[model samples]
Target: MYKATMKIFSGTDTGIPNYSCKTSGPLAAIIEGLPTELSSQFSSLSRMYHYPQISYMSGNLFMSDTVKFPYFYRTVPSELHLCTGIIKLLKFFSWTWVSIIAADDDSSMRAVQILKDGIEQNGGCIQFIKTFSHSRTIPLEDMVNLYIKTSSANVIILYADKRYTGAIKYMNVLQIPQKVWIITAEWDFLSHYSLGFDDKNNTLTFLKTKKNIPSFYKFVREVNPALFPNDSLTDLWWKDLCTNQCPESIRRSCGSNEISPYFMHCDTIHLGNIYSVYNSVYALAHALHNVVISDSANTTMWSGESQKFLDFLPWKLHHYLKNLHFTNALGEEMRFDENGDLSIGYDIINTVFLPDGTQRNEIVGSFNPYAPLGQDFTINEKAIVWDSEFTQIPPKSKCSPSCLPGFRKLTREREPLCCYDCIPCPEGEVSNQTDMDTCMKCPEDQWPNQKRDACIPKVVIFLSYEEPLGIALTLIYILLFLINAVILGIFIIYQHTPIVKANNRSLSYILLISLMLCFLCSLIFIGRPGKVTCLFRQTVFGITFSISLASVLAKTVTVVIAFHATKPGNKLRKWMDSRFSYFIVLSCSFLQAVFCLFWLFTAPPFPFHNMQSETGTILIECNEGSLIAFYCVLGYLGFLAGISFIVAFLARNLPDSFNEAKYITFSMLVFCSVWVSFIPTYLSTRGKYTVAVETFAILASSAGLLGCMFFPKCYIILLRPDRNIKKFLTKNSK
Candidate 1:
C-alpha cells in the first residue's frame, strides 16, 4: 500500500519521507491496475480522507455500487460492455458453439456469468467453462491437452489477466493451429510475454483504447534525463544505454541504436493501455480546474494562498467530477455514464507475427455500443489476412451452408432448425431465390418451367387449314364436288337420253346438289372456331345429308313400285309417278329441316376456349351447348338412311336396267359405317384432333355416296353410248 501510494502521487521532487510537504489543496488520485483487494483498501482510505479516487483499469462489479465506495469512479467501461461486445463479435463470425476460459477469481467469475447470459441471449451455446488459478493447483499442460482433444468447439474465449501466461506457453508447446482465440481488454496479446505463440493469425484481441497515441508519443520523446532525473522510463531510452568508456565517435554512432525496431522511432513504443492513464489524468485535472474557478469567483482578488483556501473545501470537487465532460489531448471524448464509467467502444485487432520475431496487432473491425441495433458491429473482410490454411475461402463456422435458388429448407427431425437440408420446390410451384421459406403458385394462364425456377406463357392450339391433314381433306372434297358438277351437267345436256331419264332425273339432280353442299359444309370445321361457323356447321351438315338420303329413299321406292305395277293386278302403279317421288323427297327433307330449326332455337354449338386439359396450352374449340339436341340431329339422319337401305335391299335383284336400288343400298351402308366410327373417335380425341376427325368423316361419307351411286352411270353415258338406245335397253330390261 505504501509503494502504490508513492507511485500515485510522489514524483522526483517529492520523496516518500516528505510526501506530506505539498498538502495545501484538495487532491484527486488516478490509479491503474488496481485489483479488487487493493481497490477495497484504497477506497476505504480515500473515503476517510474525503478525496475522489478514479481507477483506470479496475473493472470489479463492486466499484459500481455507490453506497459502498462513495468516492470511487473509473474511466474505463464496466464488464457488461465487454461481454456485450464479445457476444456481438462471436455472432458476426457465426461462432455458436464455443468454450470459456476465465481466471479463478470473483471478478472473473462475475464476468463469466455476464458472458454466459449474453451468449445465450444471442442464440449461442457454451461447450465448457474452464478456470485457472494463480496458485497452479491444476497444470496448464493438462488443460491444453484437454482442449486439443476436444473437437466440439473451435472458438475459445479467454477472460484471464496477463499473469496467466502458462496457458499461452502450453498452447505453443502443443503447436495448436487453426484455433480461434478470443481475448478481453485485460490481455495484451501483442506484449512480449505472449510472443512464444507462433500461430497468432487466428487470434483476436478486444481493446478499450487505440494502440497509437500521437500526443503521448510526443510527450515521451521530449523527456530529457537532465529535466527529470528519476523518471522510470528514462532507462527505456537508448541514450541511457551508452557507456562512459565509449569515445565521441562511437557515441555519435550509437544514435542509430536509439530508435526502437518495433516502433520505428526512439519516442514511439507500443502504448497499449497508457491512453487510459492519460485520459484519467485529464479528467481529474478538468474537475480540479472547475473547483479553482468556482472559488476564485467568490474571492475579491488573486492571492498566493489560493491553494490553502481550496484545501478547506476538499469534497466540493466530487460534484464537478461527476459531471465532467471534455475532449482529451488525444481528441477522444471523455465522459462517464450514469454509473461513472465511460461508454466502451472496442477495436477488434487481428494479431499477426512480423517477419522478425515480434508480433503486431492490425485493426480490422470495431464494435460500438452507441450505434443502432444492426449497425453496431462491422468488419472489413477484404482487409483481413486469414490463416494460411483458410486463405482460399472463409472458415466454415456455421451449422449448415445456405440453401440455393429453386430450393426450400426442410428442418431435420432431430437437429436444430438452423441445421437443415434443402428440398426442391413441388410441382406447379416455384422459388426464385435462395433459402425461401415457402413456394408460390403460378397463374392459370401460365405454368412452371422445367427447372421450376420461373413461370412461362402457355401455347394456343386449334385445328387450322394450314396443316397437311386439313389441306389433303380439302383437296379431296373439291375434287369430288367438281365430279358431281360435271355429272350433273352431262345429264342436263342429254335430258332425253335413256340413262339420264331412266332413274328419275329430278331426284338425281337433287341428290347431286345436296352432295355438293355436304362437301362444302366440311370447310367450317377446318379453321379457327367462331360464333357464326359453330352455329351453322353442324346444322347445315345434318340438313344436307337428310336431303340426299331422302332422294335415295324416293329413288328406291320408285324402282320397287314401278316393277311391281307392271304385274296384272298390282295397285302400286298409280303411286309410281314422278310427282309421288317428288312429294316423298320434299316431305322427308322438310321434317329434317324442322328438327334442325328446333336444335338451333333451343341449344346449339358455340365457340369455347379450353384451358385445363393440357398444361401450357389453350385449346380453341366448339362446345356443343345441348349434347342431346346435337345427337338428335344425327339420329334423325340415321333413321332416313336406315329406311332407304331396307327398301333398296329388297328390290336390288329386280330388272338390272331400272334397278338403282343396289347403288342406293351400298351408298347407305358406307354412310352408316363411316358415321358409326365417327362418334367414338370424335369423343375420345381432344383439342384440334376432334375437329379433324369430324371433318374427315364428313368428306369420306360424302365421297362414298358420290362414287357408289353416280360414277357407274357416268361410265356408261360417256364410255358406252350404244347401250343407252331404246332397243338395247328393252332387251336388257327383259
Candidate 2:
C-alpha cells in the first residue's frame, strides 16, 4: 500500500519519475502503525502538498499539536489518554506499587513520565521502570532479574510494540507466575507465538476498541483464498492448512479437499486493533461525504479536465474532517476533539484459562474518561478469573487489611496514607465500623460495650433489700429493735422497784425509745433509693442517735451529782434533782434538732445517679448536698457521746446503789469506736458499697449501746433477782 501511494505521487507512468515535488490528486491518507520518525517525514510531505494525513494507530503525543502538524490528524486517542487509563486501572485494583516496562523511544518515555506524575499525584508509588530496546546486549534474563530484585510490585505494566521488544517471547521464557502483566494495545497475545507459556489468568490487556463488533467479525469470516485468488497470503494460508491433516467437516464446509478444523474454527483471530482501523475508515468516509456535499452547494474550485483542482481539493477536505461527526456500524460515536484525537474508552479484559489449558479474553470491566468522577471505572468482579495461586479470593495487593470495628487507622510513619496500622478505640470511646480514622465517645448515661464497638445502657445499682448484705442488716436492725422494746417493757414493769428508782428511770425510758428509733432508721437505707428516702434517711438517723446520746449524757450527769450530793456538802443535794437531768437531756437533744433542721432546710441530700466514678454502672445513691453540714451532725453526736464518756468515767467509782456510769462509759466507747472507723470507710467506698458501709456502722453502734448499757442490767433484773435488790446493788457499787 505504501509503495502504491508513493508510485502515484512520483508520476512514474507519466514520464516524470521525479515529479514527487509536484505531488497532488490524493485527498488524504489513513496510515496505521506509522513509526514516530516515519509519521514526522510524512507530516512534512503532507504540509508541502496541502494533503491531510489521518492516522489510525499512531500514539505519538507530538501529533496532538495542530501548529506543528497542521495537516496531520488521528482517529485514535493519544498516549496521554492511555497513560490516564493505566493510572485509573492501577488505582482501581489498589496496585500502588507497580513496575513499568516501556520501549526505548520518545513516545514511550513521555508516556512513562505522564504515568509517573499521575501515580504520584494520586498517592501511589512506582517501584522501578525498565526500558528495553531491539538490541540483544541486554538479555531478557537480565531484565527479569532486575525486575525481581528491585521491585516488590505484583503488577508489571508493559508499554512497547512487539517488533521493538520481543516481550511475548521473553515473557514466555521467564514464566513468571502469580504476577499480573498489563499489556498495551501495541501488541496482542498471538496463539501460535504464545508457545503454551502464556498464562491467561495473569495477563490484563488494555485496548482502545469496543468489544463485539459484529460487522467487522462478519467481514473477517467471509474472506477466503478463492475470493481473493490474486492474494498470495491467502493462498499460503490455504496451502499450510492442506499440508496438515484436515477434518472431514472442515473440508466439506470450506469446499476444499484438505483443511484442518483448527484453521476453520477461526479461534486465533484478535479484533481489538482491527476494530480501531474499521472506525478510522468509517470516519474518513463520513468526512469525505460532507466535503462532497459542501463542494456541490458552493462554487467549484476547478476548471475543465484539470488536475490542478485535485491539488487544492485535499486542503479543502481538511476543514470538513475537522468538523466531522458520525456513528459507526457498531453504534459507537466517532468524533475527534480539538487536538484531532478521538475520545476513546477502554475495555478491561480478563484472560480466562480453562481447565484444558486453552484461554480466552473476557470483558469484565470498562473505563470511560467522560464519566463523572469516581464513576469512570466500572468492573464486574465476579466475572474475573484471577491467577491460580489466589484461588477464589482476589489477590491482596494492599499494605494492610481493613481496620475492624473497635479499631481506627494509624498511618505509618514516613509511609503513604494507604499504609496504616489499626489501633483499638480508647476507654470511653468506641468505633462501630471498619477503618475509622478516629473513635467517638459514648453518651453520659451509656457506656461502651466490652468490645468498645457500641454503647450500652449502664446498669443501675443501689443498696436494695434483695441483696444479701441489705437483708442481713435489716434482720440485725429488727432483732436489735425488739431487744430494745423488751428492755423498755421490763424497766416500765419494774418502775417502782428500788433498783430501777435508784437510777434516772425517766432518762432510761427516753434513751430506750431513741435507740429503737435508731434501729428503725437503718431500714430506710436498705430499700431502693428515692427522693423521699434520700432526703430523710440521714437527717432522721442523725437526730435519733443524737437524742439517744443526749439521754446517756443526762444519765451520766445524774449519777455524778447523786454521788457527790450524798457527801457532807449539803448544797449539791439540790442540783441532784431529776428536773436538772431532764433539763440536760432536753437542751442537748434540742441543739441536735436545730442542726438537723438547718441541714434539711439548707442543703439536703437527694437521689443522684452517679455515672462517672465507675464504668458500666450507674450508682443510684444519695448525694450529700453539703458535706460540711452532714459531718457537723455526726460531729455533734460525737461531742455528746464524748461528754457522756468523760462524765461516766469520772463517776464510775460512785458508791450509789445501781450506779449505771460504768456501763454508760463502755457503751460510749463502743459507739465512738464504730463511728470513728465509719468516716474513712464511707469516704473510700463508691456505689452500693458506700451505702453499705454507713448502714453497717449505724447497726454496729446502735447494737453496741443496746448490748453494753442494757444487757447486764437485764440479766440482773430478769434472772439474778438477788443482784437486783437494793443491798446487792449497794455492795457492788462499793
Candidate 3:
C-alpha cells in the first residue's frame, strides 16, 4: 500500500517490427502505452502511465475486470486469519468488549465483518462499530473527537488504509487514555515521520506482523537454499532491455528503489515483503525450471518432433506450480486453495520512515503475527523478524481424568487447559511436608506401607534394643559389675586368709562369672534383634542363674562344714576343702545345664505371635518361653539360698574366730531381700524391661554377697589383723 511515483523516464521503439531478443524477453517497453484503472477510489488517477507498449505487443491485458494482474497479489492477510487470531488473543487476555472502526471501502468493510464475527465466535462482544469514509484528506481533529466520544469498548480496532495523516493527527494528541490498534495492510503509516506529524506521541498500538520477516527468510535459506534460481536471468534481461530502450536518466528498477522515509519504524514489514517477494520469485522459477527440464528429458530429439512435449507442457507446468514449496525462501510456500488465493503464514509489520520521507523498514522491536488479541507472548527481539516463526498452535483438550492407584488428577477448566491433573501421594510416602507441587519419598527406614493418601510413621524392620532407656540401664549394670568385681578381686587377693575364703568361698568366683555373663548378654541384646542370638537368649538366662546359685551353694556347704567339725572328732572339716566346694558347684551347674538342654530339645523358639490392637498389631513375647524352664530356674535359686541359710544359722554359734560367719548370715539375708521383691516387678513389667530389671536385681544380690562376706574380713586382715593373722595362718597350715 506504499505510494510510489511512476516516473517513466524512457519509451520503447514500438514502431519497429524486429527486435534482437524478440524470441523470449520481457515486454515492458512495448506495453507501457496501455490504459489501466483502479477499482478502489484511492487510485482516482488512471495509474495507466506505469504500463508499457510491450504489454500490448505480447497480447497481455492490463488487468481487465476479469483478469487481475497475477504479479501483484495482495500483501494484506485474509480477514479470516486476522479475526480468528484476534478472538484468541482477546480470550487470552480475558477481555470481552471490543470497539471497532469500519472503513468505508469494500475490503476494509469485509475485514470489519470478519473481526466482528471472530469476536462473537470467541465468546466476546463488540459494543459498537464506528464507520469512517476513505477520504484522502480527512481532518485529524475530527478523528480524535470520534475516538474520545467512544467509551463502551476497552479495545479499539481500526480498519483504515495507510494514508496515516488522519491517524497521526488523532494519535499525537496525548489526551487519549484508551488502547488503540489497527489491521492496516500498509503499516508504514505508523512510522515515526510518516504521518506528517510527531508520531512518537501517538497512542496507536498494533497487532504485530512483519516483525520476523527477515528471520523467516533467513531460516528458509538455511533450511533449503535453492531459492530464486532464475533470479539472474530476470536481472540480466531486465538490465539489457532497460539499457537499450530507456533513457539513461532512470537507471534503477522497482527492485532497487530506496525504501520510503515514511517506513523508518517498519523494518520488519519491509524485510517481510522482501522475503515474500523473494519466495514468490523462487517458487515461480522452480516451477518453470522443473517444467522445462521435464519437457526436455522426454522430447524426441532425432527429428526435432515435440508433439508429446507441447501436449504435456501446460499440464506439467500447472502441476509443478501447484505443489512448489521453494522451501529456501520466506513466503515461498505457494499452496493455493480451491479459490486460487494463497494462504501464507501470517506476519505483522510495524512501519517506520527514514529521513528522506521513504518507508525503509518495519519496526523490528514490535512486529509479529497477531496472536489472539490479548494472548501474552514475548517478542524475540534478537531477530524481531523471526518472532512469528516460533508461533505455537494450541493443543486439543481431553475430558477424562487419568487417575493412578494413589493419585487423582483435578481439572480447573472444562476446555483447553484440561490436560493437567493433580496427584496425591500414597500413605507412608510424604507429600511435600513443606509446600510442594507433588508427593515425595517417605522418611528413611520407612516406606509407603498403605495407600498413598498420607505418610504414616514406620517401625524398624528389625527389633531395636538400642533405645535410650535400654542403653542407660545397660551402662548402669556394667558400672556396678566393674565396681563389685574390683572389690571382689581385692578381697580374693589381699583377704585370702583361710577364715574369709572359707565363709563364702565360691561367692567371689560366682559373681565374676555371672557379671561377665550379664555384660555379654547385654551386648548381645543391645542392638537390632536378628535371627542369630534371639533363640539362645532364654537358655543363656538359665545358665546365668545356674552358675550364680551354685556359688551360693558352695558357700553354705563351707559354713556348714566349719560349724559341724568345730567339735572334737567331726568328719565335716576334712570334707571342707576347696576341691569339695568346687565339686559341689560343678555338680549343681551340670544339673542345671542338663535340665536346660532337656527343655531346649523339647521345644525351641518361634516367631513372636501378634494380636490385633486398636492402632495395629501388638507383639506377644515370652522370655522364659515356657512354664517348665521358668520353674526350673526359680527352684534352683531357692534351693541354693535355703541351703545357705541353714548353713549360716548352724555356724552362727560355732566361733567368733571365724569372723566371716556373720557375713555368711548377712549375705543370705541381702540375697533374699533383693530377689524376693523381683517376682512382683517382673510380673508387672510389660515386656523386655522385665527381664532387664530382674537381671539387675540378680546383679545387686551378687554385689551384696561380696559386700557382706568380705568387707569385715578385709577390715580385719588389712587393718586390725595383728590379733588373727598368726592364728589364721596356723589354722590354714594345719
* Candidate 3 ranges beyond 4 A from true positions: 1-272, 300-436, 442-545, 553-584, 587-705, 708-734
- Model 2 bad stretches (over 4 Å): 1-23, 26-55, 58-143, 146-165, 171-174, 182-187, 190-196, 218-269, 284-325, 334-343, 355-357, 372-376, 399-458, 495-503, 565-606, 726-732
Candidate 3's displacement at residue 236, Å, is 29
lDDT of 3 by residue, 1-734 (tens): 11211222121333222222323432222112111123221122212322211111011112222234322222233444555555554555445566676556555566678777777676556656766653532543565576534554435666554443464445453234434343444333443433454222212233323323445433432332134455754334233322322223322233333222222322223322444344445555676688768767865455434444543444355566545545553443355433222344333343333346553334322322333433433333332222121222221112233344455444446432323465676444544332233566655434554566444544322223466666676676677667656756766775556544545545666655674575555555444444445566656766776676677667766666766677798877788677887887788878878877876776654445333211222333433456676677666776777677677766666544553546677888887878788878877765445556665775677667656765666667667767445465334312
TM-score of 3: 0.40
Worst 10 residues of 2 by lDDT: 243-252
Models sorted by TM-score, best on top: 2, 1, 3
Each prediction's TM-score versus the true structure: 0.64, 0.77, 0.40
Tens-digit per-residue lDDT, 1-734, candidate 2:
34544564565554333365445444455455576556766676657666678776677887888898887877666777778888887877767677788888887888889998998887676767888775653555587776643456677888876565455475563257566778776654534333345554777777665545665444543546566656655554554344233323222234455343345323323533566666777777887788767766765545563356545667777887788789877677778788887767677777777888666678877776766878777788788888777532555455567788899889899876657899989988899997677999899888889888999989888888888988888888899899889999999998877677777789889989999999999899987788899888988998899889988998888888777777896788998878898898888878888988898899989988899768788888888888989999999988998998999998887765567898999999999999899999988987798888998998899889988988888888888877777777667442
Arrange candidates by lDDT, highest first: which order?
A: 2, 1, 3
Worst 10 residues of 1 by lDDT: 259-268
Q: Candidate 1 vs candidate 3: which has greater lDDT? A: 1
Write down the RMSD of all candidates, one decimal each.
Answer: 8.2, 5.9, 16.1
lDDT of 3: 0.49
lDDT per residue for candidate 1 within 1-734, as digits (tens), equals 75656534444343353354454433555455576557767787667656688887776766787787777878666766778889888887777767788888888898899888887787666767888875573455577777644545667888876666665554562245666778887765565443356754777777775645665444444544466666545544536324332223222123555533332112124535566676778888898888778877787645667656765554787788788888876567778776777655777788776668555668888887766888777787766666775533345454455567677778778765555688888877778876566777877767778777787776778877788887887888788889889988988988788887878899999999999999899888878899999998888998898889889899989888878888998999899789999898889889888988887888878888887766668787888788888888889888988898899888888876646888888998998999899999988987788888988888888888889998888887889888877665545564
